[model samples]
Target: MEVAIDNSEFSYLPAQAEALGVPLPPVERLTLPLADGRTLSALRFGSEAPRVTLLHGAGLNAHTWDTTALALQQPLLAIDLAGHGDSSWRDDVDYTPRTLARDVAAAVEAWTTQPQLMVGQSLGGLTGAALAASRPDLVSEVIVIDITPGIDVTAGPAALREFYAGPTDFASRDELVDKAISLGFGGTRPETERGVFLNTRMRADGRVEWKHHFAHLAAQALAAHDPGSATAPSVLHETGWDDLAAVTAPITLVRAARGFVSEADAADFQRRVPTARLVVLDATHNVQETAPVALAGLIESATPARRI
Candidate 1:
C-alpha cells in the first residue's frame, strides 16, 4: 500500500524529501530474500529516485516511517532488521549489530549502485554505524538516530518490556492501536498519528499479530541469544572503537534527547569518529517515530561528503 503524500495533513515533510519524491503512507512493504530462505519484509518507495535506506530498531518494522519516508525524494528503503517485522526469525543466530548490518548491506546492494544514504533508528542506528564502519564502500552517508557507539550501559531489557509485550489477540484493531499508543509513542505522537504502528502488519485470519518474533527478538535485543555465532559483534562496546575511527564516510548522528544512548556516549562517539557530527533531537529513544521531522533534516544534513 502506498502512502498518500499529496494530502494536506501529510505534506509536512522535510525540504530534502521533496527532491526524493517521497509519497504519503508510501508504497511500502517487504523486500528481501535471506540466505536461510526467508524473505525479509522491506518498505520501499521511489525505486527510480536517489536511494535512501532507513533501518528500524528491534521490535519495530518499517512502520516507524509512516511520516518520515514520505519526505525523501530518494528511494526510501526501510528494512525489517532480521527477526523483526516480516524478516526471517532464526532461533540460533546471534542477531548482533554485525549480522544485522550485513543484512542491510546486502539489501542496499540490490537497490542501488551508487552509495546509498543510510538512516538507522535504535538498533538500526547502531547497526548502520557498524555497517558504514564495516563497508564504507557501499554507504554514501550515514545517519545514526538515537544511538551511539558507546551505548548506555544502564539501559537494559527491562526498559523494553512494555513495548515488546502487548496483546496480540484483539477482536478490534482499535484495541490494538490503543495498546500501541499507550505503550510506544504515547506522549510523543500527535493525536492524528497516535496509532501509527497499525501499518506494521498485514491483516489476516481476523487477528493482528506483530510481524516479528517476540521472544527471539527480545533475546536478540538483550544479547541473550546468539543464533548465528557472529564471531564478535559490535554494540556500544570498546573494541569497536576502531571501527568508528576507521569509517571515512560522512556520518551524522541524530540521538533521542532523552533515552538509552546517554550524553556521555554521544560525546564519546563524536570524539571517536573523525568524520562524525552529532545532533540531539528533542525526542525519545525511538526518535524516528517521535521526531521524524528532525530526523529527516538530520538525514538531509548527512548527505555524502561530496554533496556536503
Candidate 2:
C-alpha cells in the first residue's frame, strides 16, 4: 500500500510545460509566516516581482495552475490557500472566502512589489473578490473563473460532492486516482494519476491522503446537511455580492460553459457589478486544466499595461 515515489511537488512541471510548448521558468516554493503562527505557501514562477497572483479552489493547491502558468510565461505567484496544499491548516477550520482573503492579502503584499492582476477559480474566486474589496491596493484587477456569488451550493456537480464526501485516505495513490475517476472527476487516467501524485502524500502509516483540509470540511458539511446552516463555510452558500460591489479594482468574470456558473448566475453578476466584464468559455469547472491556453490569453488581456 505504501507508494515509494519522489516527493518533489515540482517534478511534473517539465512535462506540463512541454505539453504547452513553453520553456520552463525558474520556479521556487515560498513560505511566508502568518501572524497566527501558521504559514502560507506559494509557487513563484519567475525571477522578477510577480505581475500576477493566482489562487486555486478548495481541495486544490497551487499546482492546479501549472498548465496555466506555463502558458502565461509571465512572472506570477500561485498561492496555496490556508488549509490547502502546503499551507498550514487552521484550528477553527474556517475556510470561508472572507477569512481566506485575509491570508491571501498577506501573501500578495509580501510577494508583489505593487498591484497585480489577481486570478482565482471556484472558492478562490470568491476569496479574490473579498481581497479586492478589502485590500484594493494589492489587486489592480481581478479575474474570477467559473464562479458567481449566486451559485447554489447544493446544486454543484453531484460527482464532485460525492468525491469530496467520500473517504479522504486510500491505501495507494492509484487507489485514490481510481476513486476520483470512478466518481467522474480528475479527467483521464494519466492526468488523474499526475494530479494524484501532486495532491496527495504518503503518510508514515503507509496510506495516501489528500493534502487539503477542505476535504474533511466538505465531508462534514455533507454529513450534516442541516437546512440553512449558518455555521457552514461561506463557500457553500454565502452570496459574495457585497464584496464584489465594494471592489474598486476592475473585475472580469469568466464563465465556463460546462461549469458551475450558469447564464442566470452570470447575468446576476453583471447586474450586481455593472462595471465588470463577462467572458464565456467552452470548458468545465476546472477551466485552467481543460482550457489553460485560452485562460492564459484572458489573463493577459485583462492585465493592465500599468499597475496602480
Error of 2 at 74 (Å): 0.2
TM-score (all chains, Cα) for each model: 0.74, 0.90
Candidate 1: misplaced stretches above 4 Å? 1-30, 152-171, 180-205, 215-240, 304-308
Alpha carbon lDDT of residue 4, candidate 2? 43
Q: Model 2: per-residue lDDT, tens digit, 1-308?
A: 32343448788889888877779998898989999899898999988899899998877889999999888888899999998778888898778788999998889888889898989998889999999988988889999998888884433555666676656778889887877888877667988898888888888897778788766666667667732331225564364888999999989999999998899999989998999999999998889988999998899787654221
lDDT (tens digit, per residue) of candidate 1 on 4-56: 22123223344325545643334545467767776666767654544678887
Best by TM-score: 2
Clashes per model (N, Cα, C within 3 A) = 23, 0
- Write down the lDDT of every candidate, Cα atoms only: 0.61, 0.83
Angstrom error of the Cα, residue 245, model 1: value is: 2.8
Task: Note the residue pairs that clash in candidate 2.
Answer: none
Q: In candidate 1, residue 1 scores what lDDT?
A: 21
